[model samples]
Target: MKIPFSLPVIDDEVIAEMMDTLTRTGWLTTGPKVRALEKEIQIFIGSSNPVLCVNSWTSGAMLMLRWFGVGPGDEVIIPAYTYSATALCAMNMGASVVMVDVKDDFTMDPEKLATAVTEKTKVIIPVDIGGYPCDYDAIRQVLARPEIRKKFRAEHVRQQQLGRILLLADAAHSLGAFYKGRAIGTVADITVYSLHSVKNITTGEGGAIALNLPSPFDNDKELVFLRALGLNGQNKSAFEKNQPGAWRYDIIDQGLKVNMPDLCASVGLAQMRRYRDRFLPERKRIFQFYLNAFSRYEWAILPPCRNDDATESSYHLFLLRLRGFDETERDRAIQQISSCEVGVNVHYIPMAMLTLFRNRGYQISDYPMTYSLFANEISLPIYNNLTEKQLQIVVDTVVDAYYSIAGTEKTNVV
Candidate 1:
């Protein structure tokens, strides 16, 4: 029963695709494979807009921040409950990060976001924690308010085109998720999806940014610039420059080198091709299995996976919470679960608790909801290939661990 927290479902087909990519001459770096992946992603997310691939979510996010002209004196509001990359993207650009609290479901609370807006506010990054979509409608309403819009200062051309604060969704976990029947990519000004090893979809290590900016902002034109921006601001990629007598190129601006390679894209493309038909369904099944097993317990606070009429999670993680458990008790329970040969994890330690953000003047006490969610949350094993027998083992291990620390035993182990 030695089950791991998460595993990428790489089949023989995925391997064969990578092998085919490796065997191709002069196609290992960013080329046709990467372009095909970008198109595949556009189809999956039901978007006709441009989707830009980058080496990592952090880099893609930071690149977008630079495009918006965020820097000193500009402030980016983000939920304190998200991964460090969310805040780091803004911090790296020399912009002030204003941390706001999250809702009970771990998404950003729009009410607090309304209060966090200021004349310096240039971006609002609402993280969709645990694969669930944020309350985007409420957040959009907040940004659209007359008072909030009046305070917005557009310092750059792109910023002026948008004419208001940007809604950049940190949707690293919610790629396949939906908000009120609308996909994540279409709901935000821009949405970045992570393709890390542990993500629902993997490219070994990469990410894609879906561009859905409003009118007067041409996504196709923006795509060409961002593609070059990712390739160190070069006018042409190595793939394009490799042509006979076409080696000459030009550099426009100082940009980051974070373009996704063809080798990684091969893996992602293979998985994405069968994602709707195979991968996503298996993950959803695993999520439902956990919900049915844990819902019977009085102390188990199950994470939300679906809301029939509203949102649906991508089933990236099954975050289970223990009622009346503090951080110390939760840690002890995790140790017990580990001893049972079952792998478990905590989603995150709030950004406010980390030294980097703390030194920047953010306090844990200021974000009470973020602290509350982080203190008792435990992420369980969930992957595409987990069997029913292994699923039961995980359920049993977690429940036993809870009672072990509580000094109580249940007669029924089901």
Candidate 2:
């Protein structure tokens, strides 16, 4: 039997919603549907702040960095284990990217982050790789330290009002994840949730920014400003300008056109309506099934899911690590699994290992732990449409490949 790595669950509901958006909704781009989706997300994530939908995660992140006044000579701290987009967003804003190593669990190491802080640091972006939430409390503690706060030199009104570095969560893979019994959106000052095809919740292609800034920031006022920036700096959106006698508007500032269309927003809106009761629970069940199957094997190093009551994953990618295996062996194992018609993949190549960053003077040697995780990691199939038979095939194929590679005796099938 052949099985793909992942598949988006675009059911009849999603189709119907898309049709409704295209046919019934007169305002197609960045209109009522987009606003409704944003409101739904705010309610679902339990964030008391504004939730702004954008065209993509990268665009939302770029807007946030620009709003925070990141520019040349400024530094943005990020974990080296994350996708290149995390670093690229800051780089696009003319800010220097400061890479830090991650812990064994694949989240940013707060201790290493402490050492990397400097007076120029403007943002600390901790990625929730594979749906697992980072230790936000620990990272927050590091930023809140007197010396670290004292080192901060605010260069903009947003920076000066906060009086410290910003904590932006790259929660692309962690929309339904929970930290300390609370949803991910509220944990960070600004959490960016991806609506890409491979994410827990998909809008075909979109993203949302949960603005949970502290008091004196006026989140509502900031939301209006961000909405304008997303729409080519126009004071009035097309829908607003359509009102009778409201055609006159103003261009506030030079901003990026990254507004989310109502067409794309409709897809996610349909999925999120039943996400808590349907989608999320199904994903978590699959995670447990894999955990139960792989736990007996001493060589199968499971990815972090529910470590404690305080933290729970979105069940995005099930990254299984091979114990005592080097990079070559892991690659061979993936090939073996693929040979059996089961698709598999690696989570990512470390940012320092990428050619773009390497040319920019970054080195893999600087991030030892990040390299270690990348070497042995293999992301398995975990999607809502996966069938029981396909799951069994995946497990059997993986076990066979491991035994074949290790040249060990095959244990009896349980």
lDDT of the candidates, in the order given: 0.91, 0.92
- What tens digits encode model 1's per-residue C-alpha lDDT throughout 1-414? 689888886899899889889886558999999999999999998998989999999999999998888898999999989999998899899999998999999999999999999999999999989899998989999999999999998999889999999999999998899998888788999999999999998999999999999999999999899988888999899989998999999999888899999999999999999988888999999999999999888788899877876688998989999988999999999999998889999989998898987887889999998889889999999998889999999998888888888888785333
Candidate 2, superposed: residue stretches over 4 Å from native: 411-414
> On residues 249-362, what C-alpha lDDT tens digit does candidate 2 reach at each position?
998988889999998888898998989999999999888889999998888899999766679999999999988889999999999999999999998989888899999999
Q: In model 2, where is the ten-residue run with the lowest total lDDT? A: 405-414
Residue 381 alpha-carbon offset, candidate 1, angstroms: 0.7
Model 1 segments more than 4 A misplaced = 411-414
What RMSD does each model have against the real structure? Answer: 1.3, 1.3
